[model samples]
Target: MPVRDILQLGHPLLRAVAEPVADPSAPAIANLVTDLTDTVAHWRDTTGYGRAIAAPQIGELQRVILLRLPGRPVWPLINPSIIAHSPEKLVVWDACLSFLSIFMQVERYEWIRVRYQDQQGQWHEAHAGREDDLAELLQHEIDHLDGILSLDRMVDVKSLCSREEFERQFKANSPYGR
Candidate 1:
């Protein structure tokens, strides 16, 4: 599979809710996972950021996302949803492959439990908490599947800043920088 172009922040498709994958093991879904993996890898290499990407980011209207933690292989989540989440919220800075130039501070669950299907169509549930980063990362990608962006989750209007500004003015205080 080839790396597909990512839909930018203003693309209408980015705002449209993605459809659920009818068959997790379908050939097309497998190919989509490959493309998402390849695309996110390429972006991460180029920008030194981007840990995951959603199908909708590549203009595919499907509820799918590929996550690649540092020094780890790509993991695909099909028809993923947050089955439960902690009542506690954490404020975190988020950036997206679709709009890497901007960084926003958003509030996400401190812990989450997600249910999803693997490429083999096997169902599984995973839990993530603050230390793992997956708590917010999964929330971010899942939001894309629902036509939401980090900008939509902004803690405050003042929380939006350019990447350069974030680095210059706030990196030292950011968890990502620490």
Candidate 2:
């Protein structure tokens, strides 16, 4: 599978809620999971910063996301939902594969409880906290499924900056982690 073109901020598809997958085991969905995983991997290899990506980012109107976390397997979450979130919030300089040239400072939940399914159609749930990168990543990608962007959740619109300016002014706020 090839890396699909990631839609930009203004694209109408990005604003539309993705439809839930009816059959997680279907070949089409399986292929989408593969494409998404490959795309994020390709992004990390090229830009050196990527953790998760949603199907909508690639112009696919499906409720699916692929996550690649450190010390874990690369997996796809079908119809993922945030069942719970902590009251605490963290200021994060969030970026997306869809908009690689920009970054935004947005407040995200310090932790979240999520329910999702694997490609095999197995359901799983977990609590992802700030102890790892999943907290920020989950919020970002889940937002994509609901047609929300980091720009929408930004605590400070002035926090928006291009990659160059972000690197120069807020290098310490790098969202990337090992």
Candidate 3:
């Protein structure tokens, strides 16, 4: 598995709607999934935090997303789509691997239900509620597969803050802040 270079903003690949994986059990598809997992692991190890990685982000036009949930197993979603979304909205700070140095508040559903195929080509459904950051992360990566970026869903661009600023403010607002 190779650690593919992540495509940055302005790369045409990021804008193209990814093609569905025709054969999840195919060798090439399996390799791509392995590469994606390796890429996510590499990023997490290097940066100390990372949730998901999409094929487009790595210049692959295949609809594949790898998610690593906190305390859960690493999973792959092939050709995922949101089958249902909650009426309520939630604002979350989002940062992209492709768009480094910019963090923004994107509005997403409080809960989402998605359908996807596993590496073995089996279809499955998952539901994520408002309190589930893992669900939010999955949605974020799936957006990439659909040719959507966080910038497009930002509720207030001005509310965006640098990484340092976000951390500082978050900590300052905590109960520990004197």
Candidate 4:
């Protein structure tokens, strides 16, 4: 298990669409999945907030994602693709580990259906609806598989904020704050 270095914006690899995992049983792919899981877990333990991560963000050109839901075991999705999406949309603030400082508001489907493979090379499909951050996180990571970054999805570049600034603004705008 390893914590891979995250590729940053402007890296050509981040813009290239990832290739589908041809052999899920490959030892290298399996090792990557383990590394991704460890990386996500390490981030969550240190910062208390990561829920999902993508392969491109780690410099890998593979359609892989690792998700760890609260109270649930780590879920590995190999060759994940969004097969369906709802017309209804929602704007949410998101931050990427690759772009650690920037937070952006990107629009995403309120519901989505995705098809993917598990660690054991078995196929599976799942539906996610306005069910908390899981759906949003899933879409965010899947976008990475397709070479799409949250910055590209931003409605306005000016709306982007640094993590510190976002926290300050949120506090200032909160009702409890004088």
Candidate 5:
């Protein structure tokens, strides 16, 4: 259960598209998912925050993402892709493990249809949306798999704020908390 170091924003690795997991059944991929799960849980325990984390965030150039949405068990997505999306958009103040202390408002589709494979090589599809916090988290992590960061999705550049400032000024109405 190694909690790997989460790569930061300026890291070159964070800016490059991650490769697909060639074999979902590979031991290395399992290890990578384990590390991601450990890291996300640790971050939540220490900061009382964190929902999902992508493999790329830990410098693994593979399309794997670990999610822990409210009231659900671990959802490991390998080579996930958004097959379709709603025209509706939801704006939220987003945060990331890559830049833990920073927050910014970003626009994401209100709902999306996705297809992904599990760690065991099983394929599945699901629709996610803002109603359950799945849409935003999925979009955020999938963007990581494609080398896109929240900074690049900002709806308003002026929406950038430090965690302290965000809490003091915008936390109440911030779409991130839900």
Candidate 6:
């Protein structure tokens, strides 16, 4: 699998909702998962940042996302959907591969239940809560499938900050900090 180009912010395609994958077992989807895995891996290796990526970020208008948190195996979520979520919310700084240079403060559910198919086409429901990073990550990736960006969820204009400023001023307090 080769690393594909990541569509940057302001790309028209980034705003387009992705189509649901009709057959998770299809060869095309397999290739797409591989490409997403490779692409995200490359990004994490080069930039020291990146936890996951969605198909739309690569110009593939399909509801697919790849995630590989530290110490976890890389995997793809096919046609993922958030089935339930807590009313409680947590505000955190969020960034995207499409707009790597900007970070914004966005509110996300403290917990979420997701339904999705694995690469092998098996259906599964997973839950993540405030204690787990997946709560935010799953929300972020699923938003991509719906053509929503972190920019759309920003709390306010003042919440927006450049990556450099984020690192210098906020990284020290971030749970996601290095």
**In lDDT terms, which candidate is top?**
6
Candidate 3: residue pairs that collide:
none
What is the lDDT of every predicted structure here? 0.90, 0.87, 0.82, 0.82, 0.88, 0.91
TM-score of 2: 0.94
Q: In candidate 1, which residue pairs clash? A: none
Clashes of 6: 0
| TM accuracy, model 4 | 0.90
Q: In lDDT terms, how accurate is model 4?
A: 0.82
In terms of lDDT, model 6 sits at: 0.91
Residue range 24-112, candidate 3, lDDT tens digits: 88998889989988887888778655678999999889999998756778888898999998888878777788876667888888889
Q: In model 3, which regions exceed 4 Å deviation?
A: 171-178
Top-scoring candidate (TM-score): 6
TM-score of 5: 0.95
TM-score: which is higher, 2 or 6?
A: 6
The TM-score of predicted model 1 comes to 0.95
Backbone clashes, each candidate:
0, 0, 0, 0, 0, 0
Q: Candidate 2: where are CA atoms >4 Å away?
A: none
Candidate 3 local distance difference test against the native: 0.82
Q: Which stretches of candidate 1 lie over 4 Å from their true place?
A: 172-178
User: Which residue pairs collide in model 4, if any?
Assistant: none
Residue-level lDDT tens digits of model 5 in 1-178: 7898999989999999999888999999989888988999998889767789998888889999999766789889999999999999988889998898999999999999999998789999999986667888899999998899999999987899899998888877754555
The predicted structure with the larger lDDT, 2 or 4, is 2
Question: What would the per-residue lDDT of candidate 4 be over residues 30-100, giving only the tens digit for each residue?
Answer: 89988898888887778655778898878889989998777888888998888999999988777788787
RMSD (CA, Å), each prediction:
1.4, 1.4, 3.2, 3.5, 1.3, 1.0
Comparing 4 with 5 on lDDT, the higher-scoring candidate is 5
lDDT of 1 by residue, 21-139 (tens): 88999999989988998898898788778788999999999999999888677899999999999999999999888898999899999999999999988999999897648899999
